[model samples]
Target chain A: MALPLNYSFRNALVRWRSTIATVLGIALVVFVFVLLQSLAAGIEKSSSNTGDPRNIMVVRKGSTAESASLISRQTLTEIRYFEEIARNENGEPIISADVLVLASLPRRDNSGEANVLLRGVTARGMELRPQVKLAAGRWFEAGKREIVVSAKLAKRFANFGIGQSFKTGSATFTVVGWLDGGGSAFDSECWLDADECRSTFERDMYSSFLIRPTDEAAGEKLITRIEADRRFKLKAEKEVEYYRKQTMTAAPIKWLGGFLAVMMSVGAVFAAMNTMYAAVGARTREIGTLRVLGFRRRAVVAALLLEGGLLALVGGVLGCAIAFYWNGYTTATMGMETFSEIVFEFRVTPKLVLEGLAFAVIVGLIGTLFPAIRAARLPVISALKSI
Target chain B: MSANIVTIRNLSKIYQQGDINVTALDNISLDIASGEFLALMGPSGSGKSTLLHIIAGIDRPTNGECRVQDIDVAKLNESQLADWRNQNVGFVFQTFNLIPVLTAYENVELPLLLTRMNRAERRKQVEIALEIVGLADRAKHLPKQLSGGQEQRVAIARALVTDPALVVADEPTGNLDSHSAQEVLGVLRTLSRDAGKTVIMVTHDPKAAAFGSRQIHLEKGELSK
Candidate 1:
């Protein structure tokens, strides 16, 4: 098994052009690999599978979000007193009024329009979303003409820092502060006081009401109680469950990334395989010399395979560098749950980089095995005669 | 007196490609001394190289008993044959078949890597082989950087690096100019006389064949001793 380990190493170094081309091919494959993984991560993160779970909303029975519905204050107040309702941390019945709107704004990259979901909240709204943070400046005065933009949205938009003014219709308001939400989807939006947003939009009724169970054991009971009240004729679902439905739309994005990665890798595989095959062919004489000198057939094959794996590793490093430079840089996607715009940063974590390199090495294995085997199997007589 | 280091009896090689069954070697038998310098002289397609190849244990004979140093090469499998060749035989090709990427020193060191010798000892052996071929000063020069004669000398060094007694030279000077050819023949002559190698050379050139202590002519795969 004393194969000349330097056989393929020398060939790869000698044919520098083809070697670099193979490396570049693997780099491209790795790039696709990272891109696909990020797409899946983005979609998965956008739909929080945990928050507001089992908390039902009754919005016009069929309306999807605040912008699509008009539920009267009378109906919300009446539902607050329902006997089957649960209590909050304050020992009060779990109910809060909310108004939602679709506010279209110009994208920073393009002049094209993009929508940011605007959720106007009552006083109890702040307590309900407990994990949310006021990262900078101050919360808006109850009736002030100021709004707190999500940290992600503030970073995404142009000139959107504190005290900056933005316009919609005949009204222009100053950005008062910023908010953070522990990486939830709400970080990609703006929050306003309920009455202010209502007056600005000239709406006479609330869009939706959020509910919490007394002990979460009362969740189904509350749902049945709300649905049975025929006067409002409401349809209810847990808030956590409602967001999960967005996963169906997000599924395509995940698959799209995977499909794109596979497609790109095919070209890379061809490049690497073609290069390795030619490399094997060109070194037949050298292979024979090794065998004649005492190298086992499997040793020769393993040496060539190692060479290919090293080439792919180099490409993987370079491709990962390209992907890493993009981490935390914000980019937008359609919020599948709301059909509005959601922005997130590219997250090129260490784990993803390693997986990219691993994938590249696998591609190397696919590229070099057959060629290496052919080289190892060559008869020493004919191979030596090749030169 | 011939010591009979190699024995061949009724050896044949047939290449079958679907409908074509080509006989490359047919019922060839020969015996030579341990340190004899013999030349195989024949025209193209006379199966001289085929016979040399089979004797070197690089190819199997269809029906025969062939032995080198009393070990039956014909009975050995592919891997065993390879190991036998590595320990007992070294081949110099017409093309000087030095790895293009390796310098003269590296090419010689290549065979030594198969041995148990460490890097320091391997370097010493390679130096001796190169010094013997008169290319010790040019050891750093790659095959492409060396002249035709120098390249063939490097190949000769590679062959001698393992200290194999049986050196196979297949048209070793066929690709060289007259000057390079003369230089190569001079080295082969020195190997037989000074190093006591049993050299089997296949060459069409009368001048190259003249270097061998004796020459055997092959006509249509049959040898005339």
Candidate 2:
């Protein structure tokens, strides 16, 4: 017969002092696990959630990221005339030949200088990326020394907020507006006029092209056509797919999260084991009483396991609360793809919280296994003899 | 007056303490009839507890037969012995081994958990058991909240809740005062005389033994009747 569950819970409350240390130890581990995983998830979500599937991106054939991609003006002019390219109401091809540059800037938090990505795009660029929206002020005017900074980026870098001017080399650019990228990678960039950026940076080529396709099949056709023409030395991919690839940039953070969780879990396991061992030692007579009352070894083992699992579950919940509190909390890290600060918020997703809880259960199971066995295998006569 | 509920023959229990072979029970042969209250009296280290444990199926006999309800307990494996004990035997401890965290009602409800009865049925049985022990009003109190005599009563209620044929108690009143010990002994007397339950208790007090239907003394692992 299954033992009453409240029996285990009451025992936990009776020995709460020792239970708390084990619970808190597991809690600290879970807290670090969930938070670090949230950080990684936030970074990955920002990258993968970017761009539309109907749009196509054209970049240098061998380049892994847009920062390293360079397509000359002639190549863009040729690609825009393709029948698969979608046109706006004004009979203009819906295309953005964008430029990307890196600028070192001082952080507002005085945490020293960091590299920031400066993106140059035309009016068509805003049309292609519907995820970006102007949060304050107005979009930057074409051919002027005006730029729109992402709200997240504006908070980090000095002089990047609306109405402020920042210098990149000899040129001065004013932040005319703040753009919200809706948790997309665009939140890490500063946007200005494409032609003006090329002139200021003295670049003769564009970094990439963002194009809207007529349809889904048109996107594939465009890619095939671009790849067939080796002279252009460029490749075309669905914008959504291209952006999803950028999630690889968050790999290190994901690894670090797993590594730290595993490391801390070792300590958590030992703490739980110690608590359970003490519980067994303290309840020697009780064990004998249970056995004498005809409870099988398996039932005794299950009761102790249930107690340990319940304790770790409490820790898991506390850790989840700690992580949940940081939801939407903004931060920045250097992107492996762009080599610049990528602004993002911690996303304490439901799936991640569940993962954290599952991790705690595993630690609890390992911690309780031997101790539960010890309690169950205790000699009934000897145990009853214990005072 | 009744058939044998328990039968033992040539039962022996040996313990290897380091280099010495210590005999806890030696060639013991006995029979306990249904509804008999048998008190086993012995000095310290006389193996009274060990023999009680063996009969209760909490410990194994080193050799020979221990039959309860025609099933040889000595032949039972650990799991089967546990099942046998659960189905046929109840136990009361001297320390009143009531779980300190549980209320009196919950403690009484423990052995009933091994039965297939539902919650409502278990509740009814536990209530009746508490009433029999005259602790029905103290059901909600924790073991620590109750006095030593009250705790022993709760333990008795727990033993009876399972409705077992045999109740094995080791020093059931050893920790209580004279008045409380008499109260506990009175409860055991009712179980054997009125309820027809077989009870085997190990104790040192002759006054406690006087309550039993019959008494047997043990000295150095051999029965001296």
Candidate 3:
């Protein structure tokens, strides 16, 4: 018969000092593991939350991101009037050819400088993204050299307040408003008039086209038509799909999180193993007594494993709780696709918490395996003789 | 006379102490009757404890047969031996090896936990066992909170809780003072006399041996003439 759970639990309490040490060791490892993973999760969430399913994005065929793609005005004109494209109440086709540029700006905290994305779009482009809403002041007027900064970006970058000016490529532009991107990729960029941006940067081509289709079937048809046309040399996909592909930026962070967790868990395993070994050594006589009382070798092993698992579970919970404090906390990292700072909130999701707990339990079980077997294998006669 | 509860024939246990074959028990033959308080007295390394462990199925003999309650313990595999011991044997130790974290009540309740009895039945048996040792009031006290004598009595209660046919105690009074030793010895005597338990105890103390109904001595791994 198996020993009662209370036996393992009380033994842990009786050896509180070592129990706490092992628990904290595992806790610190799980904390680092969860925190690092949450960073990757946050970046993935930021990208995947962007774009609407009904809208389509057109970029140069070989380019991986809008910032790297170039489509000329002629190509935009050739595709803008397709019957599949949706039109506004005023009977104008809801399509926008946009330009993307990068400018290095100083941080409000004076923490060196980071690359910020500048997205120049027309009034039609603003209508295509209903998720981005003006949070303060008025939208920029056409050809005024005025810009609307993302509410999130305004909090981080210098000279982003209303009426404040920042210099980029010998041209000074004033911030006219703050727009909230609803935690989407657009939160990482500043917006101005597309024509003004092309003239100011001396660019002859638009970076990408954002188009809204009349319906899902029409969007699919438009995507298929653009991909099949050999003349334009352009790729078209649902806007949501395009943003989802940008999650590749989180791959390196995911790898780093996994690597750090694996490394720290090795140390945690040894620490737990040491604690269990010491417990077995200290309770040699007790083990023998239980054997003589007719507890089998398996029972002893199971009891010890239960104790180890419980100990690690507590550590897991503590670690998850500690990491939860970072949830919704805003942070910035360089976006691999745009080569600019992408601000996102740390997200400690429920699934991540479960994974952390499972990791801790596995570590506990592995650490206790050999020590528990050793305890069980001890000769009852000799164990009773131990002082 | 009551039926024999434990039978040993030509039992020998040899240890390989790094190539030296040291004999712990050598061709010993003995029979212990039910309800008998039998004490095996010897000095250190005299093999009295080894014999007790063999009879209790905690250790297997190198040769020959040890049958307790008609089951040949030495012939049984490890798992069967454990089940046999759980069903038919209880044990006591000189150190009063009550789990320190558990209270006296929980300590006594341990052996019963192996049985199929429900909580109420187990509680009833545990209470009776503690009452037999006159420590029912001290049932809630932890081992560290009890006197050495009280702890040994609690161990005795634990031994009797499962109502096993045989109870083997190895140096049950080795760590107790004279007064506490008497109290523990008294409890064992009561178990044999009133409860009809077959108790096999190993001790070097003449006074402790005197408390048993019968006594045997061993020397150099052999029974003394």
Candidate 4:
């Protein structure tokens, strides 16, 4: 049946105060949802740089990246001779044995000190990461104390800007360049020359080696070749799956976010139920009049439901608009993967906005069902008698 | 002397409050002919409204049968009764019952929406209803903007919009001032006397009852002629 259009729209507008409250309540819930999801998202983005299919990582058998037992510079050259490794046009192996170290620095927000990763690499680091670009400054020099800070770190902390100097025990290094790796995990660090990093950090056999396999399909065989020779004692992983596993590294945070979303959403559902139930109760006489005027019980129920659904649709749109302001808002988080501060921003993509709206509509549907049933179940005789 | 549009046999209604099952209507049987102006009169708790509700298919009798327009009302399900009401009955209340959000024109157009009438036909029907009530000028005004008499007139317009075979009005002027009550009664009198429409009204006011061609009184759920 074609509903009385003015009846529905007028009732909604007449109760502007309650409508606003419900909308704001929904807005708050959506805001919290976005914040928690964004943090979980940041952690995933920071650790997801290892997803390259043809690339392989070789870490020490006994430790993870945070506490990896180092490999020798001579061993790096020796491993370059392996047949499973790819070579450049000049016959240079597409292999890198980089130095990874952790340093604690004070945060700009006075949230105290946070640990950050410092990766030292060779000239081939640029070729290995074609996606990397200098967003603002040049690349670090070959053997100087000059270093390039990751774009993520640079944007998040004031102390890590170009030409800024930071102490690492007795030595101080100058930030001569700034690098961006298109939002990968590498953008969460500072890059220096391997020899310079060793001198500044004062001791590093080496952290791990990142390898490009000769054939994309030969990754497993290369791991077998390295493991067979007991001299190195290393483990290998395909880069993509490795990054995917790292995303699972923050399971606790994801669990906490999910738990909070579920709990607060329950409260929101109750609010919706109460408000709609009150509306139905107050309109008992009107419903009776409708019944007497020949409108079916289902039509009355549909009108009540449409009221709730309309409220939710308005709230969802406002909530999404509120989330949009958070797009690309940079922040620092202590990443569990590398035990360091990872720079990330809120990623309020179109997909996330749509997911948020879908959630509101579901909540709306659940909230309206009971009230509509109560309204429909009321007898026309009693409804007419009702005050 | 005429075909009975409504027939009731041994109809009864009981209202239970806590421990008391106070009988609102008891063992009533009657017949109402089509195109008749019948007014029902009673004191509080006299069951005049109860009988009206039963005849309108809104309230089922606890014991007995109520057949309106040849169909057993008690036997009809809620949906079917609703369909029957839409097709055959219109109701007017003491409070007018015009949707407060709607203007007089929109209120009158409500029942016509259930029919297959397009907007143009619905508008024409609404205009005729308003003209009959002499509220064509006030059609754009909301219920609150109209007077008690004007509001009731709009309510009457709404009732007649669907061209229902039977019109039920309970306490049609109970809430209005005497002058406004006279205006509403005048319109209802025109409906019954001039247009030959069937109008069943329940009222406590003897003055209003005098407007009907025939009067039926109810005392303690039993009928009195």
Best by TM-score: 3
Please provide, for model 2 over A107-157, each residue's C-alpha lDDT reduced to its tens digit, 9 standing for 90 to 100.
998989999888989889889998899999999997679999989988888
lDDT of 1 by residue, A141-222 (tens): 7677778888788866754689987775345667888998666777777888888888887777888888866656577887
Q: Candidate 2 residues B4-95, lDDT tens each? A: 99899998999999999999999999999999999999999898888998888878888989898998887888788877787788888888
How far out, in Å, is residue B172 in model 2?
1.5
User: What C-alpha RMSD does candidate 1 show over the true interface residues after superposing them?
Assistant: 2.1
DockQ of each: 0.45, 0.78, 0.78, 0.73
- Candidate 3 off by > 4 Å: none
Off by over 4 Å in 2: none
lDDT of 1 at B32: 71
Query: TM-score of every model?
Result: 0.83, 0.97, 0.98, 0.93
**Model 1 reproduced share of reference interface contacts:** 0.53
Put down candidate 4 lDDT per residue, B1-225, tens digits, no spaces.
Answer: 368888889889988799999898889988888778889998888999989998988988889888888899889888888878888887889888877777899889877777889999999999999999999999899899988989999999898888887889999998899999998898888887777678999999999999988899899988866
Pick by TM-score: 1 or 4, better one: 4
Mark the regions of model 1 whose C-alpha exceeds 4 Å error after superposition: A2-5, A42-97, A108-110, A127-138, A154-174, A180-183, A198-250, B16-23, B115-121, B178-183
lDDT ranking from best candidate downward: 3, 2, 4, 1
Clashes by residue pair, model 1: A86-A214, A87-A214
- Could you give the DockQ of candidate 2? 0.78
Q: How many backbone clashes does candidate 4 have?
A: 2
lDDT of 1 by residue, B122-159 (tens): 89999999999999999889888999999999999999
